[model samples]
Target: MSEKTGQCLCGAVKLTARNVPSTFNICYCDMCKRWAGGRFMGLHVAKDDLNVTGGDSVTEAVTSDWAKRAFCNTCGSSLWYEVTDGPYVGGRSICVGLLDDTSDLTLGTEYYTDRKTRAYDFPEGRKQLTEAEVLALFAPTDAEEGEPE
Candidate 1:
């Protein structure tokens, strides 16, 4: 496994992934879109395989049912996608941009395709979905403002 490391734009926070990911996903989830202003690539990183070095300045945001968004407080650099749901099922969706080199690996999988806006078309040639599809798969536990759960 090749070593991968990255830091915020201001160098205030940094992280390292000890091993390369076997699965990569480009998510078009609404929350992701709101967070990144568009699609955010999520590389399935093993929880135990990730380590943060200069992490004191890294900020975390709890977004949903079992998800959290991490970023640099000073630079606002999107860091990693963390899901803390206990040992066996826990994982992190690391940002590919954080890697030292991403020229070798290919895009493995794309998710949250259903949440993409109708105006933007994806180029990955992967399966596509719409808002309804996303709601069907993973809907909010409680009723939304205009929608029923």
Candidate 2:
């Protein structure tokens, strides 16, 4: 993996996810839709791998009983997330807009199919999985501590 760095729009918060995330997700969950104003493309970084720096101006909201969403208060840029207790563990699902080369990354999975809007539709045959189905993506995998195996 390469060193990829991203900063909030107002520069009040900076972060580094040292390696490519073990997985990714494109979420259509209502919570995500409400937080993202439509849909959310998230890059998953393990709790240990997400470094929150210059966070003096970062603000967080408890979007749900088990999750917290963080954003840069200075520029209103949704930064990352904290899954208090869920199938995802503690991964920080950083906003895809914060990434530098998001185009190079492959779309992994689109989640929350049950709640997706009927106003829009996924084209072709992209896999769409419900919440329980997508949770399977976070299943334990064989990998070295600091590297993808």
Candidate 3:
């Protein structure tokens, strides 16, 4: 893990992340594609590992019941996608394109593989997960419903 710094296009939103990972993931879910104007390349990091400046210029939109997406209000640059509920609450996925140095980063996973369009395709041989698989892995199970009476 290493420290990294980046900012939005207009420099209205700056961020410094510590203990950053060496790999990033891509999301091809419909919302991600629409929000990013394509696939969303993100680095999953704990909220505690990230620090943001120019927060006044950042705007967050609750896109779903469990997640919120943030962007630079001044420049409209996508900032980060954050989980707000369930097992992954407080987790943040920072936009990979915002990183100052990406030379050492590698593709970790491609999520929502089933939602990926044919218009674009990454190289083969990388790990991929469909929407169902992702939900199954991360979605919280009902405690009582799963337990035997």
Candidate 4:
């Protein structure tokens, strides 16, 4: 694990992630493809391990019941995708493209693999999880389900 720093394209939003993993993951979900204009590749970091500067230029939109996506409002650079509520709450996946040095990083997982378009293809033998698998892995726990009113 190492520290990584980066900024938005226009430099309006900057961030530093501590203890970041050397592996990153990709998401091919429809929303991710539309948001990133392709597969969304990200480095998972704990919320507390990520420090942001120029946060005023950042904006987040809740994209799903459990997750939200952030970007630089000024330059429209996708910043990170965060799990807002669920077992993975407090986890944020920073856009790998936003990192300053990613030479050491490698592909870890490919999510929503079934949704990937035929226009592109990654080399075979990579770890992949389909939408159902992803959903099962992150499904809300009993505690998160809340008691019936």
* Candidates' C-alpha lDDT: 0.76, 0.79, 0.91, 0.93
CA deviation > 4 Å runs, candidate 4: 122-149
Tell me the spans in candidate 2 whose CA falls farther than 4 Å from its real position.
Answer: 118-149
Where does model 1 exceed 4 Å of error? 86-88, 118-149
Off by over 4 Å in 3: 122-149
lDDT (Cα, tens digit) per residue for candidate 1, span 46-140: 77888887677888999987789998888788887887565526678877776666776677877777776665675678788899998888865
Cα lDDT tens digits, model 2, 1-149, are 55567888877788888777545688888888878777888888777877778878888899888999988888888887679886987688888788766656777899887777765676788787999888878765566345565
**TM-score of every candidate:** 0.71, 0.73, 0.80, 0.80
Candidate 1 backbone clash number? 0
Best by lDDT: 4
Order the numbered candidates by lDDT, best leading. Answer: 4, 3, 2, 1
Clashes of each: 0, 0, 0, 0
lDDT of 3 by residue, 12-81 (tens): 8999999999999999998898889899999988999999999999999999988999999898999899
